[model samples]
Target: MLTNQAIRNVANDLDRRWISDDYFDLIVWYETEVQIHGFQLCYDKPGRERALTWTRERGFLHTAVDSGESKPTANRTPIVVADGTFPAGQVRREFIARSGLLPAEIRELVLARIKDYEDRQSA
Candidate 1:
């Protein structure tokens, strides 16, 4: 299952930044050992719109973006660039909508995580 710890690890380790969110999922830009790019976590099951070959059916499907920018630069028009997935739980879309993870909801979690990471860096 997609534990909260996993998300925190991504935030702390990957330098995560929340850019956009919608009814389906949210997009995040993160840095890895090699490059910086964006990926998405679809709360619901994979859609038929794109040729998404999910890395996991029961977890969040993490797909690569063409560029580091989100599609449409506002909302997601998910285009399958690569196949990946996170072991996050398949929570309902409504739950995520009110989960304070999105920009419209609350930024406390994001800010706190960023602060924690920065503090660790300076320590």
Candidate 2:
């Protein structure tokens, strides 16, 4: 299970730009770790798809420009990179399978745990 603090920490790291282009690959790395640890986390499929589309589109354009197949356009908007998109649906499915919990159930559990953790920390 992923705690709220853990998620916040990752977000903060991202805000600091600690994760670079290679951060996309870290999704697989974290998923693997979760599998080995027998933990489950909630994932939004639609959100994942959006991320995939974003990363793929940007990566394709980047490669085209680098190989001289395409030229950069000053009028083109900069590509927006999202958090995790690697392995797409597979990551979410594997996580749910390994955790033996439905996505909604996992989300509820995580939320409850986060509340508990926050309460304790505050006290």
Candidate 3:
């Protein structure tokens, strides 16, 4: 089964919790082929990948958190990013892209970074 392994420390969008520097949910699954800055993840439930949908079909768009709607998956989950690394992910990349920021310019902006990115980037 897929699972969350860590969270990145930084900042988050004021309107959305999914894309943030404070807590970027990092997921790991051997079956997935996603490579969003070396971190593969799932924003929605299992089998809900938007990239698989037809071009004419509507893709998954995240909704703002609702009061008493449901609990987040990472509630009390024991995982975190170390001090030397930076956060990264598709959510952060998209957020930056949407905001007219280039991928190379933004280092500390991301929704999730791979758990081992710093080690890999350094090597």
TM-score of each: 0.22, 0.21, 0.19
Better by lDDT, candidate 3 or 1: 1
Query: Model 3: how far is 77 from its true place, Å?
Result: 13
lDDT of all predictions, in order shown? 0.37, 0.29, 0.29
Task: State the number of backbone clashes in model 3.
Answer: 5
Candidate order, lDDT descending: 1, 2, 3
Cα lDDT tens digits, model 1, 97-116, are 44554443223432333344
Q: What is the lDDT of candidate 2?
A: 0.29
Ranking by TM-score, best first? Answer: 1, 2, 3
Inter-residue clash pairs, candidate 1? 2-87, 2-88
Measured with C-alpha atoms, the lDDT of residue 66 in candidate 1 is 42
lDDT of residue 30 for candidate 2? 29
Per-residue alpha-carbon lDDT of candidate 3 for residues 1-123, written as tens digits (9 for 90 to 100): 222234444454111112222222322221123322222232323322221111113422223222232457534532222232232344445444443432332223222233233334568
lDDT of predicted model 3: 0.29
Model 1 Cα RMSD, 1 decimal: 15.4
Q: Clash pairs of candidate 3? A: 10-21, 11-21, 12-20, 88-112, 88-113
Worst 10 residues of 2 by lDDT: 60-69
